[model samples]
Target: MTTQQAETDDSDGAHEERPAAIETIRSRRSGHNFDAEAELDDETLEELIRDAALAPSSYNLQPWEFVSVQDDNALDEIVELAYGQEHIAEAGTAILVVGHSEPETADEVFQQWADAGRMDEAAAEETKATAVGMYDDDRMGRDYGIRNPSLAAQNLLLSAHARGLTATPMIGFDHDGLAEFLDLPEDKIPVMLVAVGPSGGEEPERLPRRDVDEILHRESY
Candidate 1:
């Protein structure tokens, strides 16, 4: 990561320096090639997942799980489930971002909130009831399941970049096969597959993106 900093003024008329995370966000690229021989140590892998888990979730439901594939046999299976995506095998690690369709931990989370004094008992119970009712609906539950984990996936990519690793998020996969391979429960869904490792020494040119003017709308689109 670069040591360069950007400066900005805050509301209190004090200057605050922007974090290197901005550079990480700007420079992060989706890697298509990775060094096949490279490997990620357990500590680094754990840290990556820790950073990903910090992503925000609706009602703090935190409905995401990860499966890290590093063993040769597991990688081989993942490659097949990912439709022969060679990068999955080449990368040092592959992470399966799993999402839960229901807020199964609502009771525990709300109890903690009340215990920590963040919320009164009555408020916590009411909030939990509302969240449960909304998530009980099939469509809403599914959407939250996928959407919340996607946020974590993005965080994972950025964390990898900050650690000087190349990572790619791929959606092209056999979802049913993956679920079967992982033996996921009915409520758990495979949201995304990410491969992480050192670069293969050949970097692709950055692709163009739409300019701010083209993509941005004032108040209404």
Candidate 2:
């Protein structure tokens, strides 16, 4: 979509400015309250989801699925499922992002990696063979379920930002209720809810962040 940006002090401050990627990172904020009237176009929405699909996941499983709420009546119904998160109602659209690790998806992805020459052939074959084979093995089963989908969600958020759209990553919603509302199959697990729309007022104030020195360590904390 439209790349036209109303210039701002933080963005126009310096000529030798931060790289776009770094700038996007520094400026990104979690938008909660938004103008419900500001809508996104179909072309822009498609690009946003495509960019999200670029995120990396364990085994390239890409286990995430999304239901984009378009109908006003449907959005109102889904908002109720989220326990009346006002933002969900206020947003132009809310995406029900679900995580599912069906053996079939994992198998399909693993095979693609092998065929694409990105992964070692023998290793891919072995991973493919053992992937679903290990589904019942206890150790790997639980691990893959979380690892693949979390990466996918992160990709979605960043893509939303890059597209000039803002989003909220919400864990506060009721998952079981949302699944029933969306009629999601039992195989798909709801992980997170994302509300996508345009700016409401000012961009959200940046919350405080921990310094790397405090959060990370060279070898030990």
Model 1 misplaced stretches (Cα beyond 4 Å): 1-18
lDDT of 1 by residue, 142-174 (tens): 999999999999999999988888899999999
Per-model lDDT: 0.88, 0.73
Candidate 1 residue pairs in clash (backbone atoms < 3 Å): none
Q: Give the TM-score of candidate 1.
A: 0.91
User: Candidate 2 lDDT, tens digit per residue, 22-130?
Assistant: 5565557788767788787888777777777787866666767777887788878877777787787687888876776466586678778878888887788788777
Return the lDDT, model 2, position 207: 66
Give residue 150's lDDT in candidate 1 (0 to 100): 97
Q: In model 1, what lDDT does residue 23 have?
A: 62
